[model samples]
Target: MPSVQIKICGLTTREALDAAIAARADYCGFVFYPPSPRTLTPVAARDLADRAGARIGKVGLFVDPDDALLAQGVEAGSLDAIQLHGRETPARAAEVRARFGLPVWKAIPVTAAADIERAAEYREAADLILFDARTPKGALPGGMGLKFDWSLLAGYDSPIPWGLAGGLTPHNVCEAIRATRAPLVDTSSGVESAPGEKDIGKIAAFCAAVRSA
Candidate 1:
């Protein structure tokens, strides 16, 4: 199998961003949602985006964003893709993709086998389908360090490109890849020492684990 692609998300500081780059992460994610501690201002995202300079993919994560918010994030972050983590429908995702002229990644919250079928709904609407653990109602959508059964995805046919997230860390990412053969893997809280504080050593360790997986 090919090396698992890694995405280190929820980056808010230059030191963290630099650590992700040095770790050879395939993508660096910036949160645009205000509720998350990792959220970044457009101005802040611009500085980090400039520093990134195409060395790695820059993804902007939003939750039910308006067009103005999307525009701000795209331009500010020089984003290569937009990740919609809200309760957006397929039509809405398509609209966001058309308006931004960038690839759209729709996050699917999974709890059971039936939830995996939901990816079919975004077949034409999204470039990728992110299967993250389902958080409880009234809680944050993701990045909560929760995990579902990996066997749920084993050998399941998917209509679009998919990845694994939720509760993944350096210790378990290798097993995740082996179990799901996830083309990509994402981490936010898992690599952080706190809710939003990304640890440099953890970042490197996670990436190394993925590469070796």
Candidate 2:
């Protein structure tokens, strides 16, 4: 099997960014949602993305942002990909890709078998699909720090590239990967000291687990 790719999300500080880079994370995600504790301003995100350089891909995480906000992120000049973590439709995903000229990663929340089945509808619209744990009925969109049953993804196949996210920590990331054989894994709260605070040690440990897996 190919090596699993690791993406450390919700990075807000230079220290955290440095830690992710040192750990050789395949992707570093910046939250653009204002409600998220990990949220960053376009300027702040640009700085971190610039510091990230080309060693690792910089991902802009958005939740139903408007065209103006999305354009600001693209103009920031550090994002290599855009991750839609909201209820955007396939047409919206296609529009975002065309407008920004960047690879788009559509996040699909999976809590039941049917959720995985819906991924097929986005195969042609998104460049990649991220399977995340579904939020509670009245909760926020992504980064809920909850996990769905890994068994739901067993033997899963799709034409578009895909990834796994939600509640992934160093302790269980390997098991998650082992069970689903996900090519890419995304983490937010799992590597944080607090809701929005990223722990460098945890970042390194998480990456180590991915590499070992």
Cα TM-score per model = 0.99, 0.97
TM-score, candidate number 2: 0.97
Which regions of candidate 1 fall more than 4 Å away from where they truly are?
Answer: none
* Highest lDDT against the true fold, candidate: 1
Model 2 lDDT tens row, 30-144: 8888888999998898888778789889899999989998888776737899999999999999999998889999999988999998888887789999999999876878777
Q: Residue 141's C-alpha lDDT in candidate 2?
A: 81
Tens digit per residue, CA lDDT, model 1, 100-144: 899999999999999999999999999999999999999999999
Off by over 4 Å in 2: none
Worst 10 residues of 2 by lDDT: 70-79
The residue pairs in collision within model 2 are: none
lDDT agreement with native, every candidate = 0.95, 0.91
